[model samples]
Target: MELRTLGYFVAVADAGSVSAAAAVVHVTQPAISRQLRQLETELGLELFTRGPGRLSLTAAGQQFLPHARDVLHRADEARAAARTYAAGRLERLTIAAPTTTLTDVIAPFLATLTDDDPMPTVFESDPREAYPALRHGADLAIVTEAPRSTLAARALASLPVWAYVRDDHPWHGRDAVALHELVDETVLALTPSFRPRQILDTALARLGVPLDRVVDCSNPQVAQALAAAGRGVAVVTDDARFGLWPVQIVGRDGPLRIDLFAAWEPEHHAAETLAALAARLGEFCVERYGPDVAPAGHVGQMGREY
Candidate 1:
């Protein structure tokens, strides 16, 4: 019935295996199992069903998971608040940013933080995971699409997608290309789980264009590098390009537009502060990729190569 037991139970449930949970929680499998069993015994209910190689939650466990998580979260919050009050410094703000958009998109607003406030600690995690963490405790989370769960704070901004190509690519010099024309060209895409991939697939479907899929990369950075190498073309935000990855904007597509936003708990110390932060992030993006900037000439000027 200890809090640590509930923590272990939640971890095991999430990992779907005692061994995996132990690895993540930094304990042995048997230890985690023992603690969970003890908690189950104290509660007079079967929390988990243990098989030869399977670990699954029982009905009671399924029903109790959310409550256990809330208890743990509230406990952590109380601890953090007490520490913050004593230390006279808001404990470090932990923010999650989409790996694809964090640096150039979200970092500038963070730069505005005064020396008195501790710099935010940034985490790059799956959007699915990041949203829940923000609702539970993370100070902020940046996402490409609005998450559906009511537990989350809310969407801060909606950003659109832009066409990105290699500097040396044939289309680099072009101001824009017909959306349907891109289907004939080699396309580098993110894994299907990524929002960009879903949007691209849907847009191509609507345009009645069959895409020539060439490279499939999970990491946006790798995809950007592939685009830079003239391997294929990808659509991404200017924030994703940053300074490290070189790219050229061939043009924009209406269907390719994406919104990038921040989500945070309203009950937190500075909910309004997060909104202001979101605005600054949006401004930074507009400054770099807004309508006024023409495509760089060093990039190719030719039309479609194919």
Candidate 2:
């Protein structure tokens, strides 16, 4: 079966119709329809059931869908491997991470690199999407959530989530604040997609701390600015800004923090090199963040989103 044919099949499955898949794949509807029929002929099973405008996957199709996706993912990894070796060793490095982690953690680590090291191309993704970015094209992915089982992954570090306030604010000199204390004050939080917000939300719910004066911002910098303006206490994993100081958020268990993880496909052509690079990254995170930032031991497991 053609890889293109498989791609079209997956597209059709996602789009719900051959015509709709054609639009996304940028091919004519008749060509897609013909290919789908040929695919069915080769497999000796009907993959879809015809309907008025939409198509539903057949029982066989439903079973085949996951295998098809796996095949496509493997094919993509193969191409990525070929491209990396064909281009030259360490020449095809691309890292994907959440915007805040990309800026705060990865960027700082990259700055410490010498000219001998491979300079990676970086892409900003949501905390959840960071791992999936590897399946798309990224050579390495940094995420707060656990990596998929198929990918080789390692825990980088545990970075503390912070509550930020102006230098003159009453809590600025404090080392840490209780999670329940947030309920009494206006809190500036990032959207749920960010690791800090996820950590905050989970902790608050567990402690039964219902915060009513929470202001949501899409950007951590904005959250810091709002806090500096005395709007609310900024809860984020970002570095302190706007002349603010970071106070560790104390949860019921311990200091509220997010675990950092680096993930990549172990079957990639430069798998060894990628693994080495991820190790170097983990090392740098430890060195830069200081000894207080503990190294995490979780690797290759179905762990929590935080």
How many clashes show up per model? 9, 0
Q: Candidate 2 at residue 152, lDDT?
A: 79
Worst 10 residues of 1 by lDDT: 297-306
User: Per-residue lDDT of 1-306 in model 1, one digit per residue for the tens?
Assistant: 677888998999999999999999999988988898789889898988988776898998999999999999999999988887565445477888777666666666677767766568887867788767776668877776654444234333444445567665667666556677676667667887887777777776776777665577877777677676767776655444532232332223453555665566645666555555555555566566674322122211111000
Q: Which residue pairs of candidate 2 clash? A: none
Candidate number of the best TM-score: 2
The candidate maximizing lDDT is: 2
Tens digits of per-residue lDDT for model 2, 156-244: 78899999988777887999999988888899999876778888998988888788888889999999999989888999988878899
